[model samples]
Target: MLQNWKKIMLLAIPSLISFATATLTGTVSLIMVGDLGFVVIAVVGVTNIIMYNAFAIFSGIGHTVNYLVAQNYGAGDMKKGIERTYLAFYMCIIFALLIALVGWTMSSELLRWIGGPKSGNLVNVGTEYLEIRFYAMSFGIISFAFHGFLRGIGSTTLSMVIALISNLIMIFLVYALTFGTLGFPNLGLRGTGLAILIGEAIQVAICAYVYFFVLNKRFATRILVRIKWPEFRLLAFESGKLGMQEFSLSLSMFIFTVFVARLGERALAANEIALNVMSFGFMPAFAFGATATILVGQYVGQGKAILGRRAGTDTAILGTIFLILLGTAEFFFAEQIARIYSNDVQVYELAAYLIKISAFLQIFDGLLNFFAGGLRGLGDTTFLLFISLAVSWLLFVPLSYLFIFVLGWGSLGAWLALYTFLAVFGLAVTFRFYRTDWSAVKLREASPH
Candidate 1:
C-alpha cells in the first residue's frame, strides 16, 4: 500500500509540474497582454478557447496512445507499444494539419461570427494570433504523443523536463517579442503567436531526439517501416471514439464561451483571468488523473482489477485534498490573484467573484478527472462519449444559455450554469467508476494482424 502510494506520487508529481509550468506560461501571457487593454486580452483569450478545444479533441486521440503503450508495456510487449505510439504520432500530425489549414483560411471569419459585429479590434487581432498559433498545432500534438507514450511507460520525469525547458523558453521569447525587447520584433499579440510556434518547434525537436536516442534504444521500440492498413484503421477507430468524447465536452465549452462573448469584451477578459487562476487547481487534478490512467491501466494489464480500483480511488482522494486547499486560497486571495491579471477595476472585481465561485466546486472537479482517467484505463471511452454528449448538449448548453441570456445574470449566470454542469458530470463519472466491473472491461491485444 505504501509502495503504491509512493509510486503514484512520484510519477504524478512530475506530470503536475509539467502542466503547472504550461499553465504558468498562459497566465503570464495573459498578464503581459493585460497591459495592452481589455480588448487585446479578450482577443488572446478567445483565440485560446478555440485552439484549446481543438487540442483537447485531438489530444484525446493522442492519449489513446498512452492507453495502448501502458497496456503493451505491462504485458511485456515493447515492440507493440512502440508500434502504436508511432501510429498515434502520425495520426496526430495528419489531423492537426487539416485543422491548421482550416484555421489559416477561416479563423478571422469564425471570430467575427462568434464575437458578433461589435467585436471590432478583437476579430482582427484574434485571427492573426490564432492563425499563427494554429501553425503550431501539429508540433504540440506530436508532443502530446510523446507525453502519452512517456506516461504510459512510466517515464514521466522526461516528459516534465521537456515541457519545463520548452515552455520556459517560450515565456522568454513571448516576452521579448511582445515588447520588442531582446532584439525580437514587438509584434504584440502576433509576437506571442510566433513565439508559441517557435516554442513548439523546439519541443518537437527535443521529443524526437530523446525518443530516437534514449527511449528507442532502451526499449528497442521500433518505428513503422511500413503502414499496416488494418492496424491503422483499428487504431484510428478506437481513438476517434475517444476523440468524440473529448470533442463533445470541448464543443460545449466553446459554445459556452460564445455566450460569454455576448457579455462583451471586458467580461471575457475577466473570465480569462479567472480561468487562469482556476488552472492552478485544474492542472494538478489533471496530473493525478493521468497518473491514475497509467497506474490503473498497468494493473488492468496484469489482471489486477482490484488493485486498479484502489489506485484510482487513492489518487482521487489525494487530488481532492490538494484542490480543497487550493480552492481555499483562491477564495481568500481572489482579489490579489485578479490584480495579477488586470488593473481595470471592473475586470478585477468581476474576476475575483468568478474565482470565488470556482472555489466552491473544486471537490467535484477533482473527482471528474480522476474517475475519467480510471475509465480510460478500462477502455471505457465509448461510454464516456455518450455521457458527455448527453450532458453537454441536453443540460449544459441550454442551462448556460438560459442563465446568461434570459436571466440577465451576465458572467455570474455562465459560472452558475458551469457549476451545475460540472457537478452532474463529475458525479456521473464517479458513479460509473465504482459500479462497473473491471474484469469485464477488455483491452486490445498488443500484437494485431
Candidate 2:
C-alpha cells in the first residue's frame, strides 16, 4: 500500500499540475468573455466545443506517443522512444495546419448546419476566433504531443512545470490584451484567441529547448525533417486510429449539443455553461487517468505485468474515491458554482440542474476515465472505442431524445441520459479490462510498416 501510494503520487503530481493550468486558462477566458454578455459567452462556448473536438482528435495521437514511448523508456530503449517523439512532433505540425484550414473554411457552415437561425453573430464571432486561433494549432498540437512524450519518459514534473509557465503567460496576456489594460487594443474574444496562440507558442519554444538541449539530445539528430515514407505511413495509420477513436467518443457530445439547441438558445446557453463547469470540477479525475496511462504503459514496457496491473488498480481506486467526495461537494454546492458564471435567474436555474446531474455522473465518469486510460496504455483502444460508440449513440442519444422530446422531461431528462450512459460505459470498460487480451501487447522493435 505504501509503495503504491508513492507510485501514485509520482505519476499524479504532474497530471494535477497540467489539469490545474488548463482549468485556470478556461476559467479566466470565460470570466473575461462573460463581461461582454451571455451571447459572447455562448459564442465562445460553441467555439470551444468545435475546437475541442478537433484538437482532441489530434491530441489522441499524443496518447499513442505516451503509450509507446513510456513502454520503450521503461524497456531500456529510450533512444527509440525519442525517435517516436520526433515523428509525433512532425505529424502534429502537419495535422494542425490541415485542421486550421478546415476550421477556417467551415466555420460559418457549422453554425448553419446546427440549425440555428439567430446565429449570425455567433458565426461571425466564432469564425474570427477560429481563424486567429488556427495559428495556435501547430504550437498547441506540438505542445500536447511533447507533453505526452515527457509524461511517457516519466517526467511528469517537467510537463507540469511547462503547463504552469505556459498558463501563467496565457492568463497575463488575456488580461493585458482583452481589456486593453496594457495599452493594447481591446480585442474582446479575438484577444482571448490571440492569447491562446501566444501562450501555446511559448510552451512549444520551451519544450523544443528542453528536448533538443536538455533531455535526450539524441533525438535532435533523429528528427524526421523530411518524412520517412515508411515511418510516416505507419505513424499516420496509428495516429489515425487514435484520432478516430477520440472522434467517435467526443462526436456524441457534439451531436448532443445539437439536441440541446432544439431546446432553444436558453437551453443551449445553460448546457454550455454546465459542461464548462463540469470540466472545471472533474480536472482531478482527468489528471489521475493521465497518470494511470503513463504508469501502466511504463511498467508494462518494463516487463512488469504485476506492477502495471497494480498501478491501474490502485490509481483507479484513488480516482474513484476522489470523485465521490468531489461529487458530493459539487452536488450540494451547484448553485454556488453556477453563480460564479452567471447571475441570470433562468440561466442559473437550468445550469444548476445540469450541475446536479453532473455530480451524480462524476463517479461513473471517473471510473470510465481511469480504466479507459489504462486500456489505452495497454494499446487496447479498439474495444474502448466500440464501447463508447454504443453507449453514447445507441443508448444515450435515443434515451435522451425520448425523455426530452417524447416524454417532455426537458433538459433534466437529457442530463439523466448522459449520466446513465457514462455509468454503463464505466461498467462495461471495467469488466473488459479484466477479461481481455490487452495484457499481451508488447512494443514492436521495428516500426510497423
Candidate 3:
C-alpha cells in the first residue's frame, strides 16, 4: 500500500499542482471581474458555462487519447501511442471548428434562452464574451490534447510546468487588460475573455514546441507524420461516448445555472462564487482522478490488473484525505474565501453558506472522481454515460427545479439537490468499481495499415 501510495503520489502531486493552478487562475480572473459588480460577475459566470459546455465535447477526445496512449506506452509500443495522439489531434481540430462556428453564431440566442429577456445587460455582455472567446476554442483543444498526451506518457511534471507558466501569463494579462494597468486601456469583462484567449494560445505554442521537438527526440517517435484510420475510428467511437456523457453533465449544470439565474443576478453571482470556492477542494480529487486513469490504464495494459485496481484504490484514499483537509479549511474560512470574490455583503454571506454546505460533500466528490476515472481507464465509458445521464437528468435536474421553483428553497435548495446527486453518484460509481472484473475490459488493439 505504501509503494502504491508513493507511485500514485508521484503522478498526483504534479497533476494536482497543474489542475489547482489552472483553477486558481480562473478564480483570480473572476475575482478581479467581481470588483466591477454583481452584474459583471453574473455575466462572466454564464459565459463560462457556455464555454465549458462546448469544451466538454473535446474532453471526450482528450480522455480517449489519454487512455489509449497510456496503454500503448505501457505495452512498450511508443509508435502506436504516437499514432493515437495524432488521431486525437485531428479530431480536436474538426471539433474545435464546429464548436467555434456554432458558439459564435448562436451566442446571443443561447444566452437569452438561459437568462430570459429580463436578463438585460447579462445577455449582451455574455454574448460579446462568447463571440470573442469562441475564436480561442482551437487553442484550448490543442492544449488539452497535448496535456492529455503528456499525462499518458508519465510526463506529468512537464504538463505541470506548462500549466504554471500559462496560468502566470494569464494572471498578468488579466491584470493589465482588465484594470488598464501597465499602460493598457481597460477592457473590462471583454478583456478577461481576451486574456484567456491569449493564455490558451501561448500554452498551445509551448506544448507544440515541446511535443514536436523535445519529446519526439526523447521517445524516438514521430508524432507529426503518423495516421491510422482504423485506430482513429475506434478512438472516435470511444471518445464520442465519453463526450456525450460530458456534454450531458455540462448541459445539466447549465440548466441548474439557469434555475439559479431565475432567482436573480445576486443569486447567480453568489452561486458562481460558491462554486469557485468548491472547485479548490475539488482540484485534488480531479488530480488524483487523472492519475488513477493513467496508472490504471497503463497497468492493465501491462497485464497487471491487481496493480491497476490497487492504484485506483490508493488514489481514492489519498484524494479523500486531501479533500478532508481542504474541506475543513474551507468550512472554517468560508467567509474570507467568499469575500475575496465579492464586495456585496449579501453575495459574500450567501456564498459562504453555500461553501460550508459544499465542504460536507467533498469526500463523496473524491470517491466519484476516482471511481469514474478508473472506470474510464478500463474502457467502461458506456456504463458511465448511462449513469451520468440518469443522475444528472432524471434525478438532479428535476429535484433542483422542484426545490427552487415549487418548494421556494432558492439557491440553497438548488445546492441541496446537487449534494444529493453527488452522494448518489459517488456511491453508485464506487460500487461498480469494486464489483467489476476490470481485467476483461479491452480497447481496440492498434494495428498498422
TM-score of each: 0.97, 0.94, 0.97
Which regions of candidate 2 deviate over 4 angstroms? 217-234, 437-441, 444-449
Error of 2 at 383 (Å): 1.3
Q: After the best TM-score superposition of candidate 3, give how far the Cα of residue 124 lies from its true spot, in angstroms.
A: 2.6
Candidate with better TM-score, 1 vs 2: 1
Per-residue lDDT over 351-395 for candidate 3, one digit per residue giving the tens place of the 0 to 100 score: 999999999687888888899989877878898999999999999
Which 10 successive residues of model 3 have the least lDDT summed? Answer: 440-449
Ranking by TM-score: 1, 3, 2
Global lDDT scores for all candidate models: 0.85, 0.78, 0.87
Better of 2 and 3 by lDDT: 3
Off by over 4 Å in 1: 446-449
- The better-scoring model by lDDT among 1 and 3 is 3
What order do you get sorting by lDDT, best first?
A: 3, 1, 2
lDDT of 3 at 360: 65
Q: For model 2, how does the per-residue alpha-carbon lDDT over 1-449 read when each residue is reduced to its tens digit?
A: 88887878887867877897888788778877777777777777777777777777887768878888888877888766777777777778788789778866877788666637777766766777867666777678888888888888878998999899999999999888889887888888888889998998999999887887777464443344555666566566667777776776677777777777778767777887888878855677788888888888887787775577778889889887777777788799998888777767788789988999788687888888888888877777678767877787899888888888899888898888878878898888888777765457575344545
